[model samples]
Target: MQNTVSSTEAKPKKKSLKARMQKFGSFLSGMVMPNIGAFIAWGLITAIFIPGGWAPNAGLATMVKPMVTFLLPLMIGYTGGEIIAGHRGGVVGAIATMGVIVGTSTPMFIGAMIMGPLGGWLIKKWDDAVQPHIRQGFEMLVNNFAAGILGMILAILGFFIMGPIVAAASAIMGAGVNYIISVHLLPLANIFIEPAKILFLNNAINQGILTPLGLEAASHAGKSILFLLEPDPGPGLGVLLAFSIFGKGTAKASAPSAAIIHFFGGIHEIYFPYVLMKPALFLAVIAGGVTGTTVFSVMNVGLKATPSPGSIFTLLAMSPKSVSNFIGLILGVTLAAAASFIVSAIILRRDKTPDTDAASLEDATAQMSAMKSGDSSEASSENIENARDVVANYDNVKKIIFACDAGMGSSAMGASLLRDKVKKAGIDMSVTNTAINNLKDEPGLLVVTQDELADRAAQKAPNAMRIAVDNFLSSPKYDSIVLNLKARDQMDSSAAEPKPAPAAKSTPSGALDNIDFAKISEIDFLRDDDKVGTATMATSLMKDRVKKNSKAATVKSLGINDIEDDENRLVIVTPEAAKNLKTRYTNIQVFSTKDLLNSPDYDKMVSELK
Candidate 1:
């Protein structure tokens, strides 16, 4: 049966909208994720250098101002530009971002994200337009001058036009947030923040908008709830905790370790795939967010600065030196976790089959032990759309890429794991990791991304086969992919080896009988009238299949006249065309197309021109 939907069937518009949102989320995450190291460094500096901090030297404290003002924003711009183009783009991006940074005391992280990519894209367009017209000898001269002039213009534009406007916008946004906090309506902000964070826009919300406001508030009051709003681990903790208890099979076993890493280690990205695996669990996160924020607001507890990775320890380390603030923070996390776990557990319980027997706890434990021992294999029937159609031409794949939120983290690790697998399998294939934003459409490519980012990956690499996984670090799908590639390689090798043709007879009194069959390297498909391209299309199809199956056959299409009298060539012709070829060139090898196409030893027939 064909795997397809009817042409008249309309795809759900809601899904399309969600996909667009996810793509935008991916773009925003890309701009911020790369600068995470800088955020961590700055977080550490702010924690130690403030007036009441452990190392509160007035001179050392002053460094924090310039660090956020210049260094962080410039790093963002450079990373954004590198994503769009390369090193040149990064240089121009940093230069352009300096203008925005100088124009205001507020951090220009969002503005830099915009200007950096814009600068790189403009230069890319210019290079695309000019490179074709440049003389070979003068190419180097033109390239350097063009980039320099373009960078200067962008820097000036950033200073004169973009800088002030973005500053005004940032001020207005900050004021709005302050008003919300002043009126004690700040907890309502979680309505928007929780959803955006789940969509992978956590960094954008935390660093781009909330951080600026929190910085101002902390400067005045020594703490602000804005710092805690986006970075709170309560919601993620709640979801993972619920999964640990209520989730089935591997999900139940894995959620405990994920919880520890998420709460303690502070890499919140680990839990994203868990929520994405069941989007309905979004409600649990939202509920958790609202509950935690409400607690924080009621208790009037806030952090001194934004926590970089949102770890519980870091959040505590950055908290104001007060007992009530500490209690409130702990209470908020506990209540949110309780709320989210309650809701998620209910959802999971409802999803379970009423008639199906639950796995025994002992059996579940043993299964997990087996998985840890490397005895587990990926089940083929995992949930994915158009799985067969996606890999319909699996043999054509020459490249495979893994894409993730931060190109450096999970995607890079996944690519490395798969590369090791391919190396051990002795396959000649290229496997690598790239940011989803940096990917472009190419033939003969396969892209693997987490389920949440799969839509964005498809849009970026439209021609490539795409496989979506619930988790990059531990997916069973890779096993199936490896098996498929190995099978294709084996089939191709077997098909390429030469085989004896069926028509063995005593030598006849003809020039063709003396011709050596072993010398033939090229095979031609002779056609009569291809005026309508019927023969051309057929020849292309035949050639592709033959090439995939054979190692040495240089297949080609030819009109009778185009057939060369080379000793190393053999031709397949239709029944009518064979009469003319056989009469005119008795020394040249020829076979009927019907005979070759119908032959049982297809690989042997291809090799021997049967």
Candidate 2:
């Protein structure tokens, strides 16, 4: 009892800390990420047109300093202020931001970020305190004057006070970084960075901290190694490759694809789960990070700016266009990957508990149906492993928002899948996505987020019903979401599966005559209960594609025996599954694919269904 009590108490405290950390990280990133386009524009200008740049056009180079020194910081300030208050705040934010730019000799990226939101927040506070008492018709004059006066005062204050303070802080940060390099201890920063990244602090570390420092350093040095530290995809690639080779069950199968996404697509969050599933893998990533950073430092390789997706292509684009720099960067990433792969493989192979692959990150923290009857998920924690058993009163949830750290990538894909599911189930709820920090505590809001971000989701929208999913692509929880939505609106007329568009209006291609397009309203993928995750994902992807193209066919994964023996449904299966399907049922139409998820024939196949 004592041990259980201690453990229970510890969880909330741990959750609170993580939530606070995420909140802090998200706050900083929120200021930077919205203004990334400005950063990229300046980066392109500097990269292609500066004296040391690829093109080295003196005419275009003239534009570089002005953009970086003035336009970029002002835009950042305006964006930060807009995030805090609104357009008025943005105006003041930029106003206040100008003071800092003039006050500091160095590029004042830090000062702009600080002043923007500070100006916005102060203006918002003034409005809140004074707006109710303002007379009706003269509102515009009074409001304008108030903003102007406050902004004027704030601008002066920023120039005399905040600008110098932030300049000092930026100097200290730059000195700290230089000191680390001087001691040849720069690589050790990964000891802290790697863990924070695994906790979904990648955005905070990258946008909030590294990018600002890196940009400032780049202004003087022409490039900065700080850009390479957080966005290095090498460690993640190494870990994923290890999992693909040495891991078991779903993890092994998923790692190869996850690796492609992480390395090329620059969605680094994909690898975090593999690390989370096996905590020992932290050593592998840390080792990789240290090796990569050491190689970069020794080679003196750096980029002009931070890469958005952090992909190899972006890294090269941002690289200084020198052969030696390219070699150094490639070698650093290669050796880093090699180091991580070796460490991760050894960890996987030597584990006495062979459960690393068997237990998914979701399985460790899933809390599905056990929280029914008004009990918090924590109350039913021990019993809530299976997502299918998850239940909730989604009747109160009129809108569904899939929340993630960055708000795009995984969350967008998840929203696409769930939106289709909700539409198919004839549910009327709106499904969308935004950054976790952007979530609001509005009534009828249901927030879905990855398990790692559950605490942050709660912190952002405490009143919202939060569901932690396995992943964005293929969580078993999605089916439960659909089913629960249906159950909640059982009495609604739209609760029935939607009727497919009529086939009579368009002639079928008769490519596969047996399919009988008029009779077929649905398509089925072969599903095995033990390997449900794969089938679910394939079905979702296929469904989304088919819905976009054909409009008349619904797609789902069903057991071989569960499929109806009728021409009204077309069954898609692997060649092996098709052979068994023929043995089991003669009436069902079958389309066999070497790859269900991706086939050259899929486009032609959808055309025939018309």
Candidate 3:
């Protein structure tokens, strides 16, 4: 129900913790992803102009050093600042970053990430404190002088303090990477890499952490193995190959198409659902990763740059135009895929579990969350806590934002899709897309995020009404939202278009078997512990149905112990909640449903209520 968990519940906070880590990792990447074009330009120049490169132009090679040392880190700082305080932030961020840049021979990406945000924050705080007190006509003068002075101070601080500290940290990290490579222990990183990728943290790991390390290593050695770790599609390719041959029904049919998109189109996200459907596939990917890395290590191959989409062509393009490295790279990818496919095939053939398709992405997430929290029994039922975490009132919803790890791709497309639907429905609303880290909690804010990202969205915007969707391209949730908005005009006057999707079988078999209808004057949805959100939603739905049908019964969601034991009152709950309620009440009529969020049976029961 309401996603509120009981204080005494022993559930692990793994989901929330993972979300926070994802958020932080994404923050690091957010500074770099936007500047990928710059990174690519430098990559291309290095690939073609260095003495060992194909064209071997010493003059163009000079561009490589300055680009990597100055242009890239400055861009990162500017972008990072832009994220914090907008245009002014970018200016000061670059100024602050220049300090760190001139202070060290190493690339200043990590330093820029820190100083840029710090610079923006300082200016923002100063402006907040000083702007209001400034005379109206002198706003521009005061702001300009303030930014310049602050930038100078921050630049001095960065050159003197943050720069060396970050340099030492980077040096330590570089030494660690060198040690890992020397001992051939880097391949073991895939144990964490493959799993985090499934959680949609691939970009964060690759661009945020690995890319910087790769850049640092590549500058000296002309290439880095760090870049290949996260972007290598070998393990995912192997898992998909197994799924196509061994997966059954929807999963099998979808595998071929997903595989094509993942391998050719470079959308690795396409295969995540497949691996998640059968978590044993984790071993397959991990095996593939280990095998692939071992192969890469033995062959002495590395990419000159990070592959953006992890597509084969991109990977090939980023690799040095050398036959030996090319063959080694291909061999690594092939061996990795073969390793994963073998493990995945055996696991798939032996386990005859029903297919879990892309459509059930959210369900899979909740179940996985449950399992991780050590509550496997709750996995068979609906969400341990309902998907919709309603900390704010729907009536306060005035703005809707679609959020994702990277704000540019899916979230934008999803926002545009929903914006069109809202427009078509004649609703005036601001539909926008933003990075999850940028979520601002305020009244009238509603956030729609991809199924896997729901937890992160919640932690960011707990005060915003939230909706999680399986696919941004098409979703009944979008229609339901539009209908809910339209229904605001006549919340109870008539049943708004029966929800976009069929309402959970209309009636769960035998759930409402023996209920006395005429005697009940009020229907109560029990809200306790994790059931608060669900109970609140179910109660609202029932009230809408009763009002639409002109029924006499009133519906409300209340604490489980708040309702008195009365024959005239009816209580609706999940089977688990029903048991707890029954322990406390003898006369109140209690009914149960496996899915409280989408039960049409409640509509039926409400219509028949006195």
Candidate 4:
């Protein structure tokens, strides 16, 4: 049965003024909240790992340390893009976003600090340069490639200059923080703040105050409102309050999820829906947040780094040396949660409800079921059946190539992950990591890399099917590679029970029928004295044959610099195959694997001959 609401439902009412304000606040909170996880992680690491005698870790030194450095900057870039351009804009938007992250954290705010503006500038430049140039046919693809290049270049430049500036700024900020806490705030803060921290606010102040100052010892401390509060007091109290005030319905139902999420996941985004629905409740949250921050500040209950939000795990991970700080964090979180719940409940109790609560529940359930069904169908069709089924046969696959910049870091990691995954899938494909420059013109080559680098791979191997990974190391998104492999395997399997071979066909260039000159060993132009020049000339000579015949072909030449004979054409070899060819022929023209696969001229020539 078709649901009437799906077809002609009226738009939900415009959010009230208070609702809008709450949303704005939520957005603000979102910016700060998500970073809490990072902060907690850093703080915990510092508290546990860093030596006491060493200089207090600040943003400069800490940010560059391995996973946090790369991940945090990238996250900033991605998140910034999302905020500005929604999801699609995120691609270029992230470049600008990283700028903000760095700028906000850096000391003198010079050098790589300019990355934020540079990223923004590059996005604008790309938009201007390509948006109008985009036209029909292959031009669209080209323009997209140009934009990606522009974004990447801008990101690299921005990071290069900004990284140091930000680092310096971070150092300064850290020094300043140490000064403030040790000289000014610690003495008084430790007394009152420690007590209040038991409720959760002590941690809040520590983070909020230290983060901007660049003294964020605990990474999570400065990232979110809840991070300042202790987990137990904050989320646990919130749960009880949600139940007592909102009652045992959907609002109540969501409360537990919110509690779990805020307590464990450290995601404040989950609580956004609740605040959006009840605008007045926003003030309560702020009051709770401020109260929590103040208490945390006075108690001097510090965390190690940021985690998600106010999750107990994060606080525990980042807590300072003193056990009292942990106690403060718990007390602070509980108090804040309790306070928020009380205020929210009091405000909600007076509201009247319709008598059809049961009906509402039934309708909600039905809607949820329908949504689930639709989602399932879409996932099956788009994510699984069509895209994934293309390459099912994995056994026959001989080689897997991973392409990326410098052929290091992310690509290496991705290849390793894929190898493990393929092994589990019972596929015996050999995986190798290489730069785009090293790709050969071989048959059955698979190029895998991040979407940003796909264009370069395509240029190197135009005929090879490219699989774009969403992230460097995410396993779920690796399905595209797996599916493509599976598809290829299936094709191989199908072809294994081959029918009778077709009659040989000759090419317009008089090349042997169906024979790839590139694969043939008979061609030997390498004997020519001017081998480099002859090989260079051979590429053009073979262009016509390549255009006419879609078979493996090559022009070679002898190494002698003086020879000017046509035989010299046989010695041409691509850079990659040069070593292999050097041992056999004095001079040889070797068509690259890519050249054989992508030579449209060969396809044309072969088609004409047929």
Candidate 5:
């Protein structure tokens, strides 16, 4: 009883920490995700339209300042505000942001992020407080005037108070970076950066902090090394290379492909999960980051602008068009990769799991997940074993989705990774990704998300099977999921025996009699005993087998009662279900499952669709 009580008490604390992290991640994502287009726009203008750029158009380049100084800050403010309190909040937030942008010589992006949301929150509070007291006749009057007054006061605060503070902060941050460079201690930046990157804070550090500093430096010197710190792929490259060589089982096989994607494809996020798979790998990434920073500092090299994708090609293209700069870029990347690879290889070799046993993998997975969950107590053997049961319900899911705060970068790559594995195994599973906000529960759907965002994903798709992993790029969970799906497929194929071979030609009775139709649709699978399980051996049983073949116009909006009472649409079910329904409902036409599955040209149609 004491143990159970203790365990119960621990769960809320774990949930609380997770909630805080999720909120922070959401806040940071809100600030960065919507503004990525602006970043890309500025990067392109700086890279190709500036005087030193490939196109070198001074006229077009004039748009850079307006875009950065006015447009970018305003957009950031608007987005932050909109996140807090909708459009009214966004308007005031942009207004308040101007105060910070006006006095600062540097880009005031970080300041905008703070001030915009603050302005929004202030207005939101005022509205919330005054909402009940306001008279009906004074609604518009109070709303408009209050908003304007709030906007003006906040603007003043931004200019007089927040503006100077931001300038000072920027100066201090810039000076610190410069001092490190001056002392030849630039490589130390990785000490802080590597750990932050591992925490999924790469976007915040790069876009929120470093970009402004790098832009300021670049404005004067035409280039800055600060741009590379957060976006650098070298450390990630090294880690993946090490894993490819020294990792066990599925990790070993996946690492090589991940390495190619991280290094050449310009997706640094691909390697983050690899490091997460083994937390000890953090030291390897840190060493590699330091090595790369040191090499770049030594060579006095910098890019003309930030490399958006952090791709090798983009990095090379943005390098100062000079031999020394080119050499610095190559040396930095190579050395970083080598340093990280060496350290990671040592760590992997030292921690080598010789057997790749399921129990061992579960413990390792639990440890990783527990660390990600911010729960220290979950490291026990019993807790680790229990974690394995979290996904037991997902064993036969047909569609898997990788979800993230932002749908594109890491989630997309993860889905692609699984899609390739599924396709190679000749499974017709659908694998994809979407933003967590867009996630929805569906029959037979499994949602995979980073453990940090698992709570949000669960809230969004409660009915879907959820697999939360510490990292998307690599997780033991993926291996388990794949193995389970393959096993289900094998079982399915074996179940087809003893039944008559599927009618090659369209008979009145068709493949539907054998296929588990409920597994493919929104309907629940019901057995004669009302138990739900795959009743057939052919694991490759098609989905929507009835609906896809016949023009059995589906009334998707109909409720169970509507389907029972109305005769407007055909209701397809197994013969047993049809018999059960016939005694109660006289109006609707009931089609046999086999008859629907054996629609005209059934074999050709099924083959073609497959």
Candidate 6:
């Protein structure tokens, strides 16, 4: 009896439904307020810079434009990436940021059109190719570079391919808008659709229409819908009326929060939870959406691109000349709201209160806490041993990838950092960084990224192990990460079925001694240097060989002097000679062409050869 009393005492008292609803309402308010501030900032920036009349001073433009176009997108991308992949997913997040900036600024919507899909694809690809061999030092670096290159290439390709598709999609969307206005706004349909519009359509029209066009047409057109109503109702007023009349308990609680967000914050995301809670009322929301959109279309209401979720804050950002558009917006929102409230109340009047799953909620909360503490009971020793067995029996594990957004800046830096760390630990890992969108599934792949982008990696390679890193390129603590990865790899190897070894062939050296001489001849002698001396030296060395061979006359120097001191230094050669060289050389040193240009010995050798 004492034990039972102690257990009972440990449990906290449950809050009243009213208190819970109030808390949720407060949470909604907090969430929407910051978003409103961000939307206002975006609007002000767009108004001042984006081909509009409100130009700032030249100095301000220089500072503001970069902040808005570059930094803001990057920050958003990083945040979004984190949301998807985890905290370590910043690499992919950064890439997504680059994509957004490029896509938005590039001609004919190039960056805007292709960045998201491309970034997503590259993350997936990098995850598949590099996740497995991440433990190997040299292999990790190679894989990192490969992933980066592949991501960039894929982004460019996707941009080209997706351009026409986006154009077509835009055209279709426009046509659909026209159809909805013409067919769905009839008086009979307005009975249901108008109420549905109040629930969501008003905000959609504002966000989907006005913001994209940089116009303020919706507000003005909203007046017509009001003129037709018995009490001269505004657009979203109907939704309010419906809520007042029919909403109960939580629905009633959500109504005021929705009003605050819709009216002041211009955010529509808030209403979704309410709609989800009562799916039977979804048609009501749709009805309101159609009503609002149709009314706006009929009245020729439009707005400038203010991508913030629709609320009153968005309306305030519109041009002063757009009073009519604002009026139309109000009408649409009010009408839709009233309709939804009435429909929701009517539908739910006779129904019992929906069952709440307390156990599931408690379980979810517990799991979340466990994840935070890194204490999953399911990850037991026996399971780990089994996983290792599977991995040991498996074959063809070759690559490990680190993925980010642009695949240039952050991913490259991250890859380099990871390479150094892994090397120091004496791990023979293959790691690479790529854009998130270019991933393809492969065996023996492991993916490491900022925690935010893990979801994207998982989507690409379901079987691959994903390790989250807090920092992309800098190391405060990657040692633990490496150890965790090794353990995972061992488990996977142990779990997989073993495959037969290939037939062996007798050669001059052991398999470990195998070297491709042709690769050595064509190897870039200067890849790292930025000085002209490096290029000069490499060129003089090649020239000396050419001069000595003359026709040994088939060997000719082809602009070895012309190599630049840039990031990329590719050496092209005929297939026959390349193959021969690969057969001879086991390893190659990469040098920058700049080294040759600055070398005194190269200058002397070139003179002698000449």
Error of 2 at 10 (Å): 20
> lDDT tens digits, residues 167-228, model 1?
78877877887777667788777878887877766765776567756765665566788888
Number of the predicted model whose lDDT against the real structure is largest:
2
**Cα-based lDDT at residue 424, candidate 1:** 68
Clashes of each: 0, 3, 6, 138, 8, 173
Residue 524, candidate 3: Cα error in Å is: 38
Flag the better candidate by lDDT, 4 or 5: 5
- Candidate 4 lDDT tens digits, 130-231: 677666676667756765776666556555655555666666756665675555343333334333332222223333332333333434343222234323
After superposing candidate 3 on the true structure, give the runs of residues whose Cα lies further than 4 Å from its correct spot. Answer: 1-15, 354-401, 408-433, 440-446, 462-464, 470-610
lDDT of each: 0.68, 0.77, 0.76, 0.46, 0.67, 0.41
Model 2 — which ten-residue stretch has the worst lDDT? 1-10
- Per-residue CA lDDT of model 3 for 1-610, tens digit only, reads 2222221222333466777788788888899887887888889899999997889988888999999899999999998888889999889999999999998888898898899988888888888899889988999999999999999999999999999999999999999889988999989999999999888898899889899889988988899888889888889899988988988766676678667767775667667777876788899999999999989988888998888878888889899878999999999999999999999999999996656532444333333332322321121122224322211134456889988887755577678888998897677889999888788776777788777787777667766667666556444456446544543433322245564322111123345656778788988876645655676787787778889999898887765424655778887777766544433344677777777777767666766776
lDDT of 3 at 255: 79
- Tell me how far the alpha carbon of residue 566 in candidate 5 is from the true structure, in angstroms, after superposition: 34
- Please write out the lDDT profile of model 5 over residues 1-610, one tens digit for every residue: 1110111132222445645655565575566666776766676777788876778898999988887788878888988887788898898899999988886777777788888899889989999999789988999999989989998898898888998998898788888888989999878889989987777667656765677678677766778999888777888988888877878765776788887877777777777767876899899999999999999999988886667667888788777656888899999999999999999989988994564522444334433432332321122111222323322354447798998765667888789878887786567899999767557777678788876676666566666666676667765456445544654554455466666333211113443353332222222122222211232211113345534655232223221222333343344445555543342234444444543323453454333321
Which of the predicted structures, 4 or 5, would earn the higher TM-score when compared with the native? 5
Candidate ordering by TM-score (highest first) = 2, 3, 1, 5, 4, 6
Cα miss at 146, model 3 (Å)?
A: 2.0
Residue pairs in candidate 5 whose N, alpha carbon or C atoms collide under 3 angstroms: 492-537, 492-538, 492-539, 493-539, 495-537, 496-537, 510-594, 513-594
| Comparison by TM-score, 1 against 3, better one | 3
- Error of model 5, residue 208, in angstroms: 3.2
Q: Write the per-residue lDDT of candidate 6 for residues 1-610, one digit (tens) a residue.
A: 1100111122333554533433333222222222334535644655565443267455544544455455544444444334334433434545544633454332222233234333544565566776776775676576557546654654455445544454455456545544554675433445553343323233223222223222111112311222122111223333444554565543454466455544565333334444555566666655565556556666665443343434455444543235566677667656655665566667666557753322343232322322321421122111232333322312233566776432333456567777776665445778787655455556667566544344445555556545554445333324334443444444344446385222111122112122222233232432211222343355456656646644121111222212221222223232222322222122221221222334333333223221
Per-residue lDDT tens digits of candidate 2, residues 277-316? 8999999999999999999999999998888877888888
The regions of model 6 sitting more than 4 angstroms off are 1-40, 48-117, 120-124, 131-140, 175-287, 306-309, 318-320, 338-610
TM-score per prediction, in order, is 0.66, 0.76, 0.68, 0.38, 0.65, 0.38
Worst 10-residue lDDT window for candidate 5 reads 1-10
Cα lDDT of candidate 6 equals 0.41
